[model samples]
Target chain A: MAIESIDQTSSHLKLSNPDSTTLVIHLTDDWRTTSHLAAFENVCQGLETMPSLNKVLFDASGLTGWDSKLLTFVLKVRGWCDDRKVDLALEGLPGGVQRLLHLALAVPERQGARKDAERQPFFPRVGEKALQVYASAGEMLAFLGSACVAFGQLLKGKASFRRSDLMLFVQESGVQAFGIVSLVSILVGLIFAFIGAIQLKTFGAQIYVADLVGIAMVRVMGAVMAGIIMAGRTGANYAAQLGTMQVNEEIDALQTLGISPMEFLVLPRMMALILMMPLLCVYADIMGILGGLIVGVTMLDLNPVVYLNETKASFNMTNLWIGLIYSAMFGVIIALSGCLRGIQCGRSASAVGDATTSAVVTGIVSIIIATAILTVIFSILNV
Target chain B: MNEAEPQIVVKDLDMGYGSFILIRNLNFIVNKGDIFIIMGGSGCGKSTLLKLLVGLKEPLSGQVFYDGTSFWEAGPEEQKRIMRRFGILYQSGALWSSMTLAENVAIPLEQYTSMTRAEIQDLVSLKLALVGLAGFEDFYPSEISGGMRKRAGLARAMALDPDILFFDEPSAGLDPVSARLLDDLILELRDSLGTTFVVVTHELGSIFAIGNNSVYLDVQTRTMTASGDPNRLLAESKDPTVRAFLTRGAEGK
Candidate 1:
């Protein structure tokens, strides 16, 4: 055995015995994160020339010390060997380190640790998405059907729900929602008057800004504005509350205790929203008319009494009824989507967040769609 | 060169919330390679003191030194650098809920090191394996059991190869078998790596098994009332409170 046969280096690590079938990397560094890192640069360089080598091992019982740095480097080497189908082992290492290595390697990498999820072609992906939508729609219908059944039980005075819970939800979806509703309504009214005044002033019809604002507030903007606000505020809140309960397994616990979650939870929230929505629409309309009055009095140089008279003239019974009816429809859609998302929430914190976001998106999209359809029908009927 | 100096030193430390001092006049030294424990009853501000030591909270008065450099007196960049050396395991594991375990470990390495993705991935798997979570890189924190989350938290703590690890109730929610395994892992890491540990726990098994030095924080007095080796303190402590606490209220028996 020639003494010079085993190659060594000035640094604490080296690649040795390149000519032999086995490859040996030696470690002599007092490995640490602070002072020195196990760079393994030399050994990595040597592996390039050792083409026929099939075995690898570590001799790390140098002079001083070691830590996870050394272990990390060794694990990297182990990974390299595994890829190349080489036998690797640890020798002449401390007992503690050897034991740690044993424990680390004790459990084989778990099955499905690296799932190479197959990528489908575009058409297949589109088909899958359509199928998913169909399944979701079916689930939604089933959920609404069950909710109606619970509502029937409630009407018969046999549902297991607390009136106080319904009242609390009503307060949350209505009274607590007043600030945002007022804010959005006022802004929308201001925007309407400003846009209308810009065009009306060209035709000396600037005073008609009040009529435009009042008519829009009572006809379409009131319900749509309130619907969007509630979607962001109360709808998101409902989904988050349900999602958290789902995450905590409270819904599961309720079911385990022989309680119907739909009857006890969903019914109350739905009733609260349905009961408060039309009232909120009326309040929103008043706020919006007040906003238009501010714009008319400030920007249009119109008298307050004249603006009020114009608003009164623009108000029609059919427009008011349609606005209230649309708000009621919005309430149902928002409540249904929020409660459905909550009930179907996955058991994770991120899932709760996603449910809340999905609730808002679903609520807003449905409101917009219903508005378009309602407006088209009303125009055809000349109402 | 660093062997003669203490790894950590706490001097005249005062901890509390806004003006209410929780623990005052705290002083201690953790020699290199020591498993120094900070023990107290619940609500005694054990976690608060830990925050102060780890530079998370400002002390009302006092100083903490790492390798004789006062942590509070250091510049912002120096303080940040000091903080990077710490491996803190909070009571709840505190793993990022959104990321998978592998991604959780990879974040620190990615931020601090200039390693390639392949190298970072290999290190991530190795760290997970060290915590007995080898095959669980793709699993999110919520999908795993509580014990597994704790283990994964430990894996993340060791991701950057910290010099000193601070644990808040490492064995709090673990079962007996898992707790013992954690204790064993802690001991083995200490022995093999010479990494210092400053753990906050009241679990007697862990205290006796791994702690070579410790300080007792009194709940009633809101002060650290005792300091020394735990075994020697148990046998020779004259204070009834210290004796009761050390013997776990079985002192007379």
Candidate 2:
């Protein structure tokens, strides 16, 4: 009887050659998952030393306690034995371990069901990402086309959506957003006046700080800041709301009920933001100019009346109209980006989160790009 | 067999949200290894009862006992310890959308056990294999079909090998064959591992196929109308409501 033993701190295993065709595995001690256990490789080494083993029997009578760790080791051995066409006898093991092994191995894994999680080469991954971006651009164009069609239907008085929903969205995106708009606009105006006052003070042109704050706030800063706020706040909210609806299959239900989601869902949101943007920009401009007055009176020691008169002189219809135009365009960009990303959201919780993030990013990036293009056009026109 | 030991006991349990009581004075006993079914018509608080039993929602009054310890009255630490021994399968197979099937099954084991990464992977594979999903480990929940997702959810539920499993509408959205296959799996798991099951379903085929014990909730009365073996209830129940529910599939078949 030639026997080989492999002992670990928490478990023990012994391999014995009872006959040339049969092998016996003796297991002892606690084989709990938290305990250090004997490795299955030792059994493989022992089997390699033996000649023409046809049967393997487990003797776990010395086991004090066991859990899934022991089961895992035995299963590995059983799999190895199965590949080698060796019979595995479990009658010598404990009753619980035997039953558990039988249960776990009862259902064989389906072939071709597992997917390999291999990483692609760097170039292929880059190519895949580029293709995805191109495809998404096409999807965005399609979504914009549908939005135009919905707007056309609205002009023709044939658009089908709840008027109440539009009213609710108007309240949500317009009046409810005033507190944040006021806070951001005032802070931006204060910073602009502070910077302009320092420069103008060196030239004894402190009065020009009023003109600087007024013209900047009216021309671009007011609209840009409001657009950014809406992008992060209302735009993200739009994406999350619609994305959740997509996840819950509410959009599908709407389609099944023969209602156009573009008309019923997207249109109301776009209209609300479009109608609110110009008005919000005007309100933000007033708040910004008021902030400039505060800085002029407190920091620059300018009379409040003088600051107001200088600000009034800086005002003109062209700059006001240009800023309004920017606000309107930004409103459209924010709404379209938010709704497009939301509509394209995949059906998962993480997909909704991605859609929300993408909406804010797309909204902000396009807003800046549109501002740059519009500013260049206005400067060339000398308006 | 010997006298079956009680695994879960509900006494004078009242479940509801706010002031509206949905189920009142509910009492039942789930013995060890019993495939217990909670059945009722639509809108009869079957799922609510499940929520109460699983510690997701508090009972309005009275007690829920697991192995003779009161669940609601227990401290938070004790409640968490007791809850750790439960496995729940939601109606929609609510798998984590961000993780693959392997990761989903591996989470509970990682959180609760000190097993090495390799051992956890082995246990994850075994659990997935038990639910007939051995090869689909790398796939995400959204990548699979509805039936496959349910099976994957079952694999995750069984990852920690809980003593009690709570299933909410296991066959709600599955086709007939897939539903029957799941029923068979439940039966096999119960027979082999002796895990207690509390299944909330109205599907008659599943109710009769796997449930050896059950409690029927009544919507109008806001309480349980019957409690016993599902087969025995079907054969001997005299309550017309219970009779109607049990024989619902008879007319369709």
Candidate 3:
């Protein structure tokens, strides 16, 4: 009998080849992962030498412990036997273990199961991403141009989006934004007054803090701060909401129903933000002046009347108009960034999250760039 | 598995969100190893019913019991313990998109058990193979086909080897062949493992193929208008709505 050439591990696995036709592997009492896999691999190598072996009957009657280690070993043995076209069977393994093994090997590896794409060079990857951004910018510009057309149609009383939807967007972009706008604008005004007080105190001109805060807030700080807040709040909200609808195929459904997404979705948001930004800037201007008045009265012990007169004297009509104009421009950019990212969102949940993040970033960056350009233009015009 | 003891029982159930009662006065018992189905037309709250049963949404009234334990009445801790025994396959395959398929299936095991990484990996491979996704261990959900995603979802559901499995529209959006493969896989698991199934679907072919006990929810009436075997209902029920649904609006031969 071929059982003479037996490989044995007292506490682990044992292979007893009783004949050329059958190899009876007697698994020991311990087959846990701690037993390691060398004893099992010995069986696999043993099968390579047994060219006459036609069947494998694993007698696990004496096995007291089993885990994934044992199953891993068993699957390998099964594969080796399969390669040689030998019959392999588990005679007395536990029912759960047997079922698990059967289930694991029930389905063969599916053809073409994994798609492994080759990695691109660093330059190519960067170039591809740059090209994507360029393409996205073009799409965003096209959307903005169409939104302008929709605005002209609305002026002529011919735009077709639901009036209620426009009202809702106004409430969303205007009223819902007030709490955050007031909070940010007041804080910036206080900060400006404090910083100006520190410098003005050296010359015994602390009342000029009101002049500094009022001029800065009305000309730039108030609108820029409120614009950044809206970009993070309502702009990101628009992107996420539309991105989710895109994920759910609602945008596709709307198109199939013969509705223009630009007219129905983008125009309303753009117009609402555009119309609301100037009004919000006016409120912010007043709030910032009050904030400066708070610091000038309390921190510097200046009379409220004196601070108010200084703030009034700092205001110029052209600077106020330019600030409102900048606020409206920032609003258009924020609306376009949010809506464009949403309309171009990929059809997935994670894609929606990405769109929201990109919208916030794009809106804030565009606001900063526009702020710099407007400052240069105002200084050139001697405002 | 005790044949005499019912695995789940819903008594006088009323399911809805907030004040809107979608279905009321519901009653059902899912005996051990039975393929119990909740069938209805679109917007009939079949998925909502599944949510209430799975504890995703609270019932407007009444209670659901799992193996003599009240799901709603249990303390939060006890309810979580009971819910651990349930495995649900969502309609969209709700796989974590950021993770690989193997990682998705291993999550429940890692959460509930102290299995080692290698052990969990082995079980992940086994589970994926069970649903014909043997070599798709490292692929993300986006790379896979819709039909394959459903099967992978099934694999993730079965990862914990739970006593009861819940499937929501498993065959929806799948081609007929993939759909039949899923039905066959469901039948195979039920037959071999004696696992109880509660499926929500409107596909008639899937119903007659795998459903042994079903309740039909009529949208017009907004209640369970019919219950029992689908085939017998098709033959004997005189309710035109039930007949129309069972036959899928086709004239009976």
Candidate 4:
């Protein structure tokens, strides 16, 4: 009879000899990951000395934990002793261990064997592998191309928005956004005019204060700042709206019905944003200039005629066009990022949130990057 | 004597993702105007097989022919042309949530046809009527119940009066009443329109009610073990997995 104490801390082994046979074998369930293969291999080698030992009982009840690689070693040892016609009886397999053994039914024994098998790879041959790589690359390229084409289709359908959908987006995205943009633009202009007046008075050149605020607000600052704010506000909203639809299977529903999700979903939103951005930029321009005019007329004690004339003269068609174009670019970028992220979203609530966050981040980053690049390019090209 | 060509022919189909082989050598045919159900447990490639049949996901190895034309092997435009003949009711019905019932149904009409708004509206109403959701045209998907949403989706799918209709778990995620109603609708559509139907589901009630023919996918072997009438297969099949699944309801009782 083989009796053993079930120690809670130290390791314990239980060897049950089912058959009547005299066998000498070292049995230890103190199976650490480090000593796993060595201990199992030592048991196999020790069996070589006992010729009469046709049966060996190895118990694993006391081993609280073991990794896959260690269990794999035990299976290999079992296989080795099995081939020698030695009945290696494994006793006290934990319930968890039994489940794991059933789970990973197939695994390689030797590293060399795995290496040899991996060297001459199966499943997908070289040609098929190359084809798969090419196919995936082609798929990615096709997706990008489709995205561009989708954007183009949206642009072409700029005039094709359903009166209702366009109006809804306009009311929600543009009209609702106006109050925020106007308030911010006015505050920005006030801050700039105040700063310019204070700095210019020290140089006794306070007259130029009106000109500085006028040129900056009308030319670039108002439109660019407004665009950035919209990118965060309305842009993120577009992404969230469409992204939610994508995750919720609405977009897929459209596709299944022989309707293009992009054409139906993105085109309408893009059209609305495109039409709204330029109008919003113009509104911001007016508000920003008006804010600065208040400071110039009251605080700076400047004549309305002089200030108005300077504001008119300091800004021109070129500056106006630059602001318009960049703001439009920013608007397009926002819509593009939002819709793209939305379509690319995975099927989970978290994925929709991720898309919304990425849409805002990408929209803002792209706007800044494009603005900087366009600034340098426009300056160099004298646009 | 119906002598029309088989609506769908899947020969030696192998569908899967990456290194994980989902199913292999799946061969079956759906006769014209037949209601065919594909039944299997969860994660048994039932959806993937449905995708392949509808030409949504290409098979890793094999061909799926729709009305004798290899839809996937054909060019994109040709594929779209072939796709026009088949209507699909995706699982969850996948109706356009933003659009109202009428607009959602009119989407296909708006896309591939030059049908006037009046004509499209008439067609939409007709489809809605067929699915028992008549006069609910202005209702947004969110405004309706799940049963109505599924009916709305069915209305949308039937917009083109397609020759073949594919239902991905049509009765899934529905109450017994709604599921039975959906099954009845499937039979009604087959009776009235004579359209071929392919449904992917494990609902035994729907299977018994609607399936004129079917295929059972075994998870262990990762292949179709039986393809025929459910009643015969359940009573006669020797495969334990097939028996386990088929008699699952009996076991519960």
TM-score of each: 0.59, 0.61, 0.56, 0.77
DockQ, each predicted model: 0.01, 0.02, 0.02, 0.42
Please give me the DockQ of candidate 3 compared with the native complex: 0.02
iRMS, all models: 17.3, 15.0, 15.1, 2.6
Those runs of model 1 whose alpha carbons end farther than 4 Å from true positions after fitting are A3-10, A34-45, A61-63, A82-85, A117-127, B1-253
Residue B133 alpha-carbon offset, candidate 2, angstroms: 40
Clashing residue pairs in candidate 3 (N, C-alpha, C atoms within 3 angstroms): none
Model 3 segments beyond 4 Å from truth?
A: A2-12, A15-25, A29-57, A64-72, A79-108, A117-124, B1-253
State the lDDT of candidate 2 residue by residue for A1-383, as single tens digits.
Answer: 65544232223777776778888888888888887766777678777766688999988878899899988998998889999999999999889988999899885774544787889999999999999999988988999999999999999997877676799889988999999999999999999999998899999999999999999999999999999999999999889988887775456434422347899789999999999999999999999998898899999999999999999998999999999999999999999999998988998999999999999999999999999999999999989
| Top candidate by DockQ | 4
Per-residue lDDT tens digits for candidate 1, residues B38-137, read: 9977878988887777776799999999988999999966787887788877676767564699977876786578999999999999999988999999
Q: State each model's CA lDDT, in order.
A: 0.83, 0.87, 0.83, 0.76
Task: Check candidate 1 and list the clashing pairs.
Answer: A110-B135
For model 3 chain A, the run of ten residues with the poorest summed lDDT: A250-259
TM-score of chain A of each: 0.90, 0.93, 0.82, 0.64
Predict model 1's lDDT versus the native. Answer: 0.83
